[model samples]
Target chain A: MSRHRLTVVISQAAGKHPVKRALEEALVAALIMESGLDVSVIPSLYDLSPDHTGRLFLESVHGDMVVLSWLFPRAAFWLLDRDGIKGHLGETLLKPAADDDDDDGEPEAPRGIGAVDVPERHIYCIDLRDAATHDPFIDEVRRIAAECRTRREEKDRAASKPMMVELGTSLTANGTNGTNGVIGEHAATMPTFTAEQLLQAPGRRWYPVIDYSRCTNCMECIDFCLFGVYGVDGLERIAVENQDNCKRGCPACSRVCPEQAIMFPDYKTPAIAGAPVGAIGSLKIDLTRLFGGEAKDAVAQAVAERDRELVADGRDAVGMSVGIAKRQADKPQGPKDDLDNLMDALDSMDL
Target chain B: MGSVSEPLTFMMGKYPAVLPAELRYARNHMWCRAADGRARFGFSSYAVRLMQDVYFLDWQVNVGDVLEVKQSIGHIETSKAQSDLFAPIAGKLAVINEELLKDPSAINVDNHGTGWLFDMEHAEGGDAGTMSVQEYYQFLEANWENTQRILKGQI
Candidate 1:
């Protein structure tokens, strides 16, 4: 029996995502028991930082076969493409195809590895779609193993010089360089405010958050957004491109998102407070909540300053408080995190 | 482990609980039990708990297909997450749990019994040492401790 060492790369964020952990545990166990191959599971958490993807690239180059699960597929491919492996591997894998002998009706070998025009000889994509009955995947892995063995044999026989396939200018023209890089006019245009700058503005509290757990990369959110709020990342995943342009309290694109991966944190809260918490003239009550003070004069002074700010500039806050009153009246809180809702829906079913 | 339905619980906390001692175990926390020369597989109670709120099961492998140990035969999905279900041993798939497919929460509620995922004939290659009941318990205990350490930021 030939021993095959494969790396399974899992993508996670910095914060602990239970889903990613579960998938990693289950996948590692399965590979060890069923595939009977030497396997190492590598986690490439996206937020790991200043060198998040660089680490993944270094680790990925050592694997004979790389299995990308969950969010890793896009990031892995992007990394390989960025490092110029996509072109070289594409040429190498495609070279064998030109002299192909198999005229039989076997499924054509998978193409488009590493985000470029590369054959997927060494890459395997596993996601929710492949969660059930992955016999086909196992078969593909065996095929990759055979392919690698043949490559090794040929390399040993010839001791040939490595070929560097230059990715032509056409690839850049085709916007295949990096998915995150903006194409055409938007490349030069900067957003109105950075997320950090926007964070300082208090009234502007609502924007879409991507639930990586459920996003399917369908790109409906990308297509539906009029403002440049969403952009396709290097991995072809929809990302919040410009947090500033996303109209505060407006969830129009979110409603169109097929996966319902978009969410706003304070969806239940009205974007702008409606004339205070309690009775109209209860100044002392409002003051305590605002200034965290018991002194009557201090509390009253804080309330006056706050009310002035709300009356003068809060209504016009450009970041996220812009059209919230109208949005609140027109549309209900648009699609909160639907995971729990989906569970609820399922739990209520008779089955 | 009593019957398919009655699994044994060894709660370290709210999670990482339950195991069926009679069944052989996979590191993935799936279990395989041999009965009448056929191997029955299902998520161990601990695994089901980890999955949390499983709402759907997609059985991909059909009956009569030759199975390799650890090959994914199906997936169970919670609202927010989906995980592939792997076969525990090599065999020919003989039966699938159709009832459980319609009601996937059963895998959470009664993972050992009616929620049994699939059955295979002629399972192969698993040894008593790595896959037996006691070994699985040990694995669970270690995993629980590791999880505790992680929670405490010891890692």
Candidate 2:
């Protein structure tokens, strides 16, 4: 075994999001039996608390880490930071396609690579949507592990000699100079990770992660959500309380949040899946409502999508009866399309 | 009356999709314009109007990748659906509109101009299966109902 194993965090998806499940399963099945990796499957990272057992175990590690979760890279990076697992964001060449592939300009390593308690350690936060299939994921993980081994080997040379000299002095003082005694002391440094050491329990959870940067605390989400997935904290700010109460595959609540703050990171659609397209323009779930495209209004579509899930779940369709509120200045108008301008022109005549 | 719903009907009253006479069109609703023997590609206005809104787009192929006709080069995503973008003409990808990846709604705003998908180098057999603007419109009229079904998610 290597001197220190890199912890690979597999944050399990909440609902049976089929593609997420399939890719996650493929990854876990392939990686679990590997010797060098310390793999742990915790519940969704978005819902994790700093005090959670799994998170505490994660923080205890003084080495490299990899986090696989259903979140945008930006969201996932901040989520890890929120959970007290901090490291420089590891760059992955694997995007669906990166905006700029050339790395010639930024030649040096990012500023804070080894400037901490753990030198040369990084947190490779891989979005499950980073690729379509598991081969890319598998290749990336193996590559990361190999890179970690190389870093450790380089660090060991500089750090190991001083430790050995110090150990000799301590051993002589204790009159334990035998080869077996040295062997025993060295063996004590070997890391111990068993099935029970992983702190978090396994449970499927699905919920919205409020990007507080964008959330205006409008309570529009709380008002719009039929399920009790959202609630207020002591200060009455929105929080995802009762996350599992979120209806599976029903992203209707996301469509209704006028601020576009809600993100179902595992959700299939890019904006809902937490792609950083932008705040307002990207999150406009019904972009057609701007131009003369959509047949139904935003609220109507959301209600229909929500009601389908409700009916499927053997519940009554609320159908705009509950959680429907008139939003004020709901959407910031982009420069009007020709259609919008025409509609404005016609509406002025009041025909 | 064609009575085709959405984009087609919606476009009929105001600023219908104008097909440039010089451009060549693939049956899959992609347009290819030749510049200095290289082909520049994008979604046709009809295709863009049919899509309604483009929320996100990502290329599946790299800039240097050699592609074949009908090969899914990337996908364009709107609020409701994600559709693969097939290569309109087969050649090595010379340039992709990286700007459009950031804000794919540009496709909805200007599918013909700044919203072009990619360019191909030393592109081959440009006239093979492509049609002129009139012929493409004829093809649309011929397959109007089936095309309507596709747009309506029935097929």
What fraction of the real A-B contacts shows up in model 2? Answer: 0.00
Off by over 4 Å in 1: A1-351, B1-8, B14-16, B125-130, B148-155
Candidate 2 lDDT over A93-212, as tens digits, reads: 566532332332232222221212322368888877667787887788888888877776787776764242221112222323233333322223323334454435545446676655
User: Per-residue alpha-carbon lDDT of model 1 for A122-220, expressed as tens digits?
Assistant: 554333223433344455555665666576557556765533233223221232113233331211121222223222212222346554434666676
Clashes of each: 6, 1
Q: What is the TM-score of each candidate against the true structure?
A: 0.31, 0.44
Question: lDDT of model 1 at residue B7?
Answer: 49
CAPRI classification of candidate 2: incorrect
> Lowest-lDDT window of 10 residues in candidate 2 chain B?
B1-10
Candidate 2 — which residues are off by over 4 angstroms? A1-6, A10-64, A69-71, A74-93, A98-123, A128-204, A279-294, A307-351, B1-155
lDDT of 2 by residue, B1-155 (tens): 22223223223236477777667777777777876767777888777766667877878799999988666566567644465566666678999898997778778778889888888875554466677777766765665554443333211
Clashing residue pairs in candidate 1 are A34-B69, A34-B70, A133-B74, A180-A234, B4-B112, B4-B113
TM-score of chain A of 2: 0.52
Candidate 2: lDDT of B19? 72
Model 1: per-residue Cα lDDT at residue B150: 29
DockQ of each: 0.01, 0.03
